[model samples]
Target: MLNELFTLKGKRALITGSSRGIGRAIAMLYAEAGAHVIIHGSKPSAKLDEALAEARALGASAEAVSADIGDINAVKGLIQAVGDVDILVLNASMQHYQTVPDFDPETFALDVNANLRSCFLLLQGFLPGMQQRRFGRIISIGSVNQWRPGARLAIYASTKAAQFNLVLNCARAYAADGITANSISPGVIDTDRNAEALADPAIVEKLRSLVPARRFGSAMDCAGAALLLASPAGAYINGADIAIDGGMKL
Candidate 1:
């Protein structure tokens, strides 16, 4: 029974933003753990095809899909195209940073629509299927800025904070149906998304200095925790916004 709790044998999992970075890491890891992984991203590309082949090589049934989560119609189509899944890992996110002194409202709004609204729309399309099944795992990738707001990203941080609450709210209502919803809050992960932040040598040093662990985080680092939370091992876990930040929030 204990082993079963962590076992993902015969499960099917859908992961968004899986073409690269954290999303891809989670999808590949899920495949390694015995779940058939379905990868979702913007559109078809050679990179996506490569990732799909890698999963198949690992002996998991995998498919590459494309959709714009920000569009309700596209989200519905994505769901309809995939049919159903036992797990949903929402790892796609949009972020922009600028000193408040020069920030523009239009771009801020775009960040909100992309980072936050997309999740809501996707959930609306996918939640019903999970609720009916009474067994599902939903994991959303969040950011530590939601808890620790700072300069250069106030608007982005606000949207992230809201995402945290949205996840908890959904968990509260959906846990009864055996769907465990949680958020994995990454710290300063070294991904394409944060390329600019890392390009500044001083900025990298300063941020690294702030973390108690004193090291940069990678997608694999977050994946280690995500695997556990995404499996039956985490059935009892709901409404948890766990920070995978190496004590950065602490």
Candidate 2:
């Protein structure tokens, strides 16, 4: 029955920002494991539909939805679109790279809205259903920056840190209802967005030196942690931050 513990049959999952990258990986894996996956992106696109189609190709029920998650009204609309999900993945986030002196207030607010505030709003919309169902999994994608802050990443780090705390609070608040909340923290994953960051020979070497694995991680790495956490195998793993960082934090 070990394999059955990992099964997601009959479970409905809504994963925000799942059109690409780590979120996409998790969405695909969940569908492959028998979930009815909702692939959510910030806006509608052919790419989003492709992901939905892929999930269906995996022999699972799937659909796609779009909304500006940074906007509370849009987040509400997104919740309505998906209805009640047994698993919620808060993976949509934004970042601004600016030194303290160069930091723009508007950009900072945008980061807060997209990262932290949006999480709160989503919990507001989904938590009641989870509580009533007495079976829910909430997974937020956190960052290593929360523990190891990088230059020009103050706002990003702050939001990530708050996300961790929020997960802990959620775990405490909903444990009695049989709901679990957790975070997955990734480090230097080789994604399209980080391709340039890892392109420079000097930067790549420096980053490699920091990571004991001597290479950047893949989206599938985070997806592995997520799949476990959202499965029955991880029923007792609440309020934990699973780091897919390849020992970068050490």
Backbone-clash count (model 2): 0
- Model 1 gets an lDDT of 0.84
Off by over 4 Å in 2: none
Model 2 C-alpha lDDT per residue in residues 145-208, reported as the tens digit of each score: 9988888888899899998899999999999999999999999999876877778999899888
Window of ten residues with lowest summed lDDT in model 2: 96-105
- How far in Å is the alpha carbon of 125 misplaced in model 2? 0.4
**Candidate 1 per-residue C-alpha lDDT over 145-211 given as tens digits, one digit per residue, 9 for 90 to 100:** 8988768788778888888788898899888888888999999898877887799999999999889
Checking candidate 1 for backbone clashes, the offending pairs are none
